[model samples]
Target: MAVRGFLRGIGGKNAMPQGASADGSERPLKPIAMGDGATRLQLLDEFEAGGIGWFWATDDQNRLIYLSPAAAANFQVSHEELIGRPLTSLFTLENGEDEEAAERPLPFLISARTKFANMTVKVDAGGDPRWWTISGKPYQDANGVFLGYRGGAKDITADFERQRDNTRAAHFDSLTGLANRNRMTRRLTAILTAYKAAKRSCALLMLDLDRFKAVNDTLGHPAGDELLKQVAQRLERIVGPKGEIGRLGGDEFQVILPDIDDRGDLGELAHRIIQMISQPYSLDGSRAIIGTSVGIAVAPYDGIEPSDLVKSADLALYAAKGGGRGQYRFYSNDLKDSAQQRREIEEDLRDALSRGELRMYYQPVVCSQTHKVKGFEALMRWEHPERGPISPAVFIPIAEDSNLIIALGEWAMRQACEDAAKWPADMTVSVNVSAQQFSTDSLPALVTNALASSGLKPRRLELEITESVFMGDAATTDAMFAKLKKIGVRLALDDFGTGYSSLGYLRKAPFDKIKIDQSFVRGSTEDDNSNSAIIAAIVSLADALDMETTAEGVEAMDELALVKKRGATLIQGFIFSRAVPQEEVLEKLADGNFVYEPNGPEKQRSQRRTLFRRIGVIHEDHRYEAVLRNLSRTGAMIEGLLEVPVGTDLVLDLGEGQLAICRVRRSQDATQGVEFETPLISDGADGLCTRHRISPYALAAAGMPLAALPPGHYAMPDRRGARPTDNRRFMQVDVGMGASRAA
Candidate 1:
């Protein structure tokens, strides 16, 4: 019954109402008339005692004047202790999405002397997690003097937590706990917009697993889900607080790195990501191996908008995968064309062999001590009718992706054996066995047939294989190895010391030689890196295993000397000779010339790339078009500026937001050699670029509307009949001819 009805009945001389006490015993309510002071106080006492709500009052100073005794007990504090405490000491308003609401501090509300209702706040009750919905009203005294708040509060912890959990579920991925696609998209858009205004740089990385589908197909979807979780954890560990990582559906992921544009640092991070992700994984007592390819794009330089930047990165990723798995590539403007070209090559490659456009060339591998030819490695060449010669590095990965490598490998093995049969009796021929070819049960039979058809001795044929062939079932891999060994042919580990090298496999596999990768051989003598030590260790290990070691890519005499001194048994590189046509090799051997003397640069020096492309050269406020003749990490050579003086300062606009400050060190007629003020860093490829660039947003702030970086220098005037304000300092020269001449 309502309190008013109960009170009215009590004073009507009817009957006292029955009520249940705290101990569940029946009790009679004391008779009291409606509007009586005792009745109102008893009503409030019952409300507080029932744990539905609590009353509090504060003085004009906002300090507590009174609080319900039961509320004080809940706080684990005595009523007297809380009597003089500040009202804000017990509760604080939580910040909410709407800033203009009761999210304001409790102190502000009391100070404003305004009524506030149902403001959710955090309850400071002895460190226990609790929330309360509090309502309060400010009052005035009889003399019109201001008074503090009279408030009531009720617990709302459960309700508040449920809302928070729902919000989190909306933004996070339930499987991996990373940000979902929607949240990632929103976050990237917001960040790009804010950073554009701030003129800051951001990098976006797109990653796709190389063989993720294989895992899902073989191990089951549950294991694939588990693998994705592990991948997220590993990425989190590597990225830390540097950026945000998100799973962009399927086996693809993205990362947003703000305020970072240095390609050097980005390349290193990408490399680490590939290496860490490529490591072996264990799932449900089964072992799996997979790799990743990364494509990176920086903001403002690559694109001013989010969609454009994402497209640029995706193209770069496509290029990286096209180059090979387990690699990273930085986005460049030309990648669009490169992507189109890659598709054309893939389409054309399907019928290149049938058209008889493929041929095998051999590069000699010679003894380090005697410099005499011991063997030759078979390399494939594709002479495209319309596109000219194509490098194997470009087409091999394409062939592998299309499942055409098996046919290509079989033909190469047969042709190489046929060619080797005409060579010297003691000379051997090495044919590469791709991972796809080695995985099949027909490889040994294929090898046996090639040897039989060519009438070549079994001992004269060597199958060069990479470490990737080991990424199969251990028993199956061992059986393949045993069959190949039983075929009476030799085996050599190609590109050893690269890619998931393990001594455990080396101990059991029967191999005749180990060919050190070129990456370790280059610059071993030029820098103070540990590459030299690594080379020595590989040779020593090969010697201990009674296997010959060949150092590859030895182009300079200093590198040759170092590798030889390190006890390498053989050498294979440009220092001897690049791969030549099979006919040329046969002709040379027919003349009984089995020795190729070492011929290369006496010393290894910094690599400089030769090119002839138009670039902008700026002096003062004038920009002139020039042809860049060559480029290096430290400097460049340019033509089209006649009689330029030495020590002249100029800026070379290398396009795509790269403005390189440089000084002319050598000037002779139309040729000028310049030294960069700061050394250029790698462009995550075989090129150099400035570490930082001007953002398009900054240009927009300077009167140009925001857009992607346009072609040509920023200060280049319109070439359609634009006049120069001052006389040109240097004369223009025509370098298009074989030589530079006056224009």
Candidate 2:
């Protein structure tokens, strides 16, 4: 009989008795009596035993009632061993065709006692790693009871592995071995959805490599690719296990930090990323220096959604690049406005020289031992018609990025030379040089023209350059230096120890002076900082080379003392005097005396700037208005609390997102000196600010999910709906308005 004939014969009418049996009941199919039919049945059994398709059955208890002999042989087990075992125990289900399917296939169907078809499963116990595809149907008798399951299976190990490999390829980046954008975006969405319910915080850092294009342009794309690999490795070291890092393609990357919201820690991590990534990289013996700029945004504060948060971080990255690359910034609402303002400023800077809106201010660099002015460093002051006196920190970078730096540099040099020529012949005038200006071929001629036009000797003019000038072609830098040396002007290396300090450049470059960067002096008064020792080492090295050392940004008396004690030849900072107008320099010289008095604070304390702004004085539940006469890092001098005894605790609502818990350390008349419970930290520049403010996260529970603190007086939101109580201790008085009667 044919194969189809054999399959139909088992259920044929002739194969079983169609009439009633001896008990007058319907009879089921029995064995066929034909010899060829038995032969066909034997052939089918032989096919199953010859390692072809297999069959299985289970009882109502899900115990395997039967197992194919060939299938058991392939499992390297005997038929008796698998016959009575549970089906799930023989193989683990692989969640069906959907690689990312959520529901567990086999167990779910088994628990429901439902029928399933073509479920792929991995063999639990294996020799060469076996996988099997299984199908089953729940069989029931006339009583409607689930008697058992009859199933069929076939090996599918090869096909399943091929699909697995294809899935991995789609989810990962080939270059960095990080999650590709597709997978990361999905992961972020899932995580944020889950985290939103839990009310947890997450942080996102967006990064773009600075000067990466320069590397790719100089070297080929292959080198750029190699550099990216190194960058990913360094990032892994810094962010190990803290979060997931994904390369969003090219030089841009994103980091997902779960449960981290502290800006201070984020800022530090961002700083480390910039610093470490900016370090020199050696690719096939060709040295390259590239930096990174990072922008950070925290969840629920920056954005509740991924796109919004990513945009916030991207805007911050734009701001960081605009502010000067190689730094990091936290997301702020003002960045958008600032970006536009910067663009306008960049445009205005183009004609600033011709319009004469820029002027030079002279900061006296004093001789440490004599406390007399040895030189004046020419600093640019942009007296913008609208913005008024833009900081060099802000405008200089913009000018450099634009085409204005070369012209600005020329003007500064000529003006400084002319001014120094009019000053006492013994004093020198130093001028800063941008990397772009120094790299230009016209710099040599600019220096020569300035000296000749001003009728000043070259010895009286000094040129200050940072280490960044050495980043370009060494031959060009060498030639530029030789030309300046030929002009016989004194050279100073400024902002030393802030970059990859290659001593080889120090050895070759003809620098007459070494200017220690302000970073080393920032916390040198502390016993723990290695900055003091580093400063000492720099001074010693400079002295060994017969180069004068000037410690820049010595803002405190203690810093001044420390630098001078460490053998610094000159000090330039606020402790001595701030940048003054040229007329003041003339006045000091007119007296024929170079002695300049250090008119700063008497003691080496945290520097305080005097202010006359009003602040809220909170006592218990009542808030009083008081004048903030002066503010420091650790304390403030407030005037208004009349006769407030020393040691009285108060909270100062320093408007615009600051609340300080202070204790009155001194009380005289209406003036009180209050010390902060926590000292303030730097705002990445000369400004001081609080480290952590009252979070908007805590405010949302009170019915306001504030994105940021508003600029106005804010009372602490009362969480409980209880009776109000106001305990007024001190009488509210305003001396400016003539002290009123006590409340």
| Model 2: how far residue 203 lies from native, Å | 1.9
Model 2, stretches more than 4 Å misplaced? 1-174, 179-188, 333-337, 424-426, 474-476, 597-599, 609-617, 625-633, 637-643, 654-659, 668-671, 683-697, 705-713, 719-727, 734-743
Give the alpha carbon lDDT tens digit for every residue of 338-453 in model 1.
99999999999999999999999999999999999999999999999999999887899899888999999999999999999999999999999998899888999999999999
For model 2, which pairs clash? none
- Candidate 2: tens digits of C-alpha lDDT, residues 435-535: 77887888989999999999999998899998777656566678899999999999999988886676876899999999999989888888788999999
Task: Score each candidate by Cα lDDT.
Answer: 0.86, 0.81
User: On a 0 to 100 scale, what is the lDDT of residue 62 in model 1?
Assistant: 84
Distance from true location, Cα of 46 in model 1, Å? 5.3
Worst 10 residues of 1 by lDDT: 95-104
Error of 1 at 391 (Å): 2.0
The 10 consecutive residues of candidate 2 with the worst lDDT sum are: 682-691
**Which residue runs does candidate 1 get wrong by more than 4 Å?**
1-146, 716-723, 737-743
